[model samples]
Target: MIELLTPNEMQLADRLTIDSGIDGYALMQRAGEAVSQTIVAQWPDTKIVAVLCGTGSNGGDGYITARLLKVAGYQVTCFTAGRSAPQSYSERAQRDYVADEGVIMPLETFKADEFQLIIDALLGTGLTRNVEGKIAACIDEVNSCNKPVCAIDLPSGVSGKSGQPMGIAVKADLTVTFFRKKPGHVLQPGRALCGVIRLCDIGIEAEVLEQIKPILFESWPNLWGALLPDHNPDSNKFRRGHVAVFCGNVWSTGAARLSATGAARSGAGLVTVVAPENALTVLASHLTSIMIEPLGNDTEKLDTDVLSFFKRRKVKAAVLGPGFGDQERAKRLVYTVLQSKTEDSDLKTLVLDADAITAFKDHPLVLFAAIEKSGLQLVITPHEGEFQRLFGNFVKGKDKVEQAREAARLSHSIVIYKGADTVIAAPDGRAVINGNGNVLLATAGSGDVLTGIIASFCAQGMPVFAAACAAVWMHAETAECFEELSPAGMMAEDISQMLLKVWARLREMATPSPSPST
Candidate 1:
């Protein structure tokens, strides 16, 4: 689980490292040397290189890079942006480059056609305002060249804190970042703009992270693998945990079945699909290992039957939404489930997704109030559209991570904001950005499959936030495996079946190794 730092955190890390012992300029030299080495390795045949330097430390690194490239016999042209004189480390880097006989060109004289490789050091992670005037023009020219570009820290004009582009940004073929990666490196628009990211160690020791103590991490097995339920020899079916999935109407029963299968395959001991009487036949025919229970079409009976099953089976978790229609009845079912309880135990977990999330769009506070009363560990899975509907005016312009964190805080539930870059935020403020998953997961019924996976983990005694992180990573791993067979043709059911393989690998990883012979 690699730590993801924000721009402010990264600045503090650098300051702390310099204060500890290492010279700031020495770190800049190392960064320049690393970038120079990478360029030579990636493009051995390159002759001319254009280095676009800003007026700050990012430009300092570019200056040193230009000097190193010149020493290696490459025709290097250094272009400096802005009218201010280089200060601090950048001043030293410029003086050294000039001593080495490297010519620093003005932005107006720099030509994109003259170079084979373009190094975008125009702006670094500290940039907050939109790119405008000369800097923006320089970025525009570099992008228009269509030549391969290598960014120094991050692509010029990309927000290091948020992954958003500031008006316009340079789309680099490769990005070289020093020390640890920033949130922008893994987040959406910035991740896309940064083609291939290469992390270079520039003399910052690992211990610096101890003082910074970044809360966000890249989603991986090491982050939440230890939290998975153990299947001991003495474990029984009931001990493993039971999951109940609320089915949609007769015409839309497949979604519920998908959720049930996902729950069963994800290590839930028993999975039952609580369906309306009209949908029982379809669900029973589609499911074999999973059980099906019928609740009459009457809303009053449906509420009573669901509560009765929760008490009778000691159900650990429940999944709602999916193909369930978005109507008053669906909203009523959510309310009933939240309000229902067992005599001796509270409803441990619940997953609300798709139509279930949209059902409370107009009055989300009512749902929040019920969750507060029920004391249920809740997980809400919402894609972009659903998130917009549920969160409404609160998350209009916030970034994905911020949006999820705020939503989690407001509802006091784990919020899984789904996308290419899925972010799982807990109410206490810990968040993880999923690094796994592929484009193949964009297929239909994928969210339904995710709903089951998360609920199953929660039912198996994993904490709500950890369960969500594990489910997201496993879902991505399943998609990665499915990609090997058929990238485009694989369906949601394929992912459910592939969970067995993913779980096998996870179990193998968790097993203790044999001790060495004495």
Candidate 2:
């Protein structure tokens, strides 16, 4: 269920299901039944419904749903735009619905205000180009009506591969997708358009995944929760992991403090804020449980001081950027972390965010070369603006997931492309589309909190990809938990404070209970 299939992959799944002795029409029936059941369960009082059908299998699902609803005594109307002559499984569904005396109306005859609910089965996941002509008009008509829409598979004009809208798209109140969800269901305009997604099991066996080998997955704990470091009773502070966070100047220290607290709360053994001498007082005043080390004021000495601190403190992971200003010093610090290694130990991992990402806008190749030289386990978190500043030209036409994967491959690092639907991609082309985030994460300093969380995981010996995915999922979970407390009043600090609660919940879920005495 965590695997996200592309539209083509879904088509292959359908073909595979059909080849396995299950009739296509039978699958359509099951899909229709699931959709109808969901609608009835969610809106039991609805008496009138409109089912919009196309000439494809999606229309077949609508026709079957219409027939079932008619049989149930609800006033169901089937509206067809260009589906006068349905093809293949759709034709069969149309024939059976006609045999049952179901009402089929032309698109012109259908009025949006006349129905309590609208079932949009006009386009499935096969769409590639922008929607146009009569289909576009029908989408416009549905959108203009403001009626509650339940889309089949996907909203009509949404690209199944990318979440972007093609020309125009239906805004669905609920989207019922068969089997697994497509990337469009989770990835921005499409995710927003699909208000509430209901994934229905329509008889597609899980074994098909062996052949498909889908690399994309939904960002959830089930995908990476088991990879989290287990708490051992015998382990001491140093065994957990140590994270060093670089603080900004005196006036801009809040972001670093937020990151330090986040690391401390997210199970890091020790959290230290490596601050400039000018910023030490501000950082020390705000930080209680976390420790702070003061580096000299000279920017030229910053790199040497950081390298020395890493070796002396045996820092397992370091988080750079956050509130650090976009300066040459930031670039130097990144290069130093990337190149710093001792006879006894090397800097194994780092989380680069905010200013660190922005600092390499003109010299990304230099940063990439440094990564190659050191073979650092790196996680780079960048929002759209920061991403545009760094890899915008490289990822111009590609979708978000592809952009992240390509970036990860090019830099030989894990890329956490932050947004409402964050896409975490690894160098090997594996990706995860995060669905746990909400608008509450829109606040400032949220990304800093995320950086610390990821750094903590990396410090604790999680694989780079799993650490990035776990951090993104937990960050979103914190935002969700914050929403439960005050939906609109959430600050970035709330996310850091709530990390322990989220970790407790995840640990409880991962822990096994004693079996019953059978």
lDDT of 2 by residue, 399-424 (tens): 99999999998888899999989999
- Regions of model 1 farther than 4 Å from truth: 83-87, 504-518
Candidate 2 regions exceeding 4 Å error are: 84-87, 297-303, 342-346, 508-518
Ten contiguous residues minimizing lDDT sum, candidate 1: 509-518
lDDT of model 1, residue 179: 87
Sequence-dependent TM-score of model 2: 0.95
Q: What local lDDT score does residue 182 receive in model 2, on the 0 to 100 scale?
A: 96
lDDT of 1 by residue, 206-249 (tens): 88888888878777676777777878999988888999998888
Give the Å error, residue 320, model 1: 0.3
RMSD versus native structure for model 1? 3.6
> How many steric overlaps are in each model, in order?
0, 0
Error of 1 at 22 (Å): 1.5
Alpha-carbon error at 393 in model 2, in Å? 0.7
Q: How many pairs in model 2 have backbone atoms within 3 A of each other, for residues 3 or more apart or on separate chains, i.e. clashes?
A: 0
In candidate 1 the C-alpha lDDT for residue 383 amounts to 95
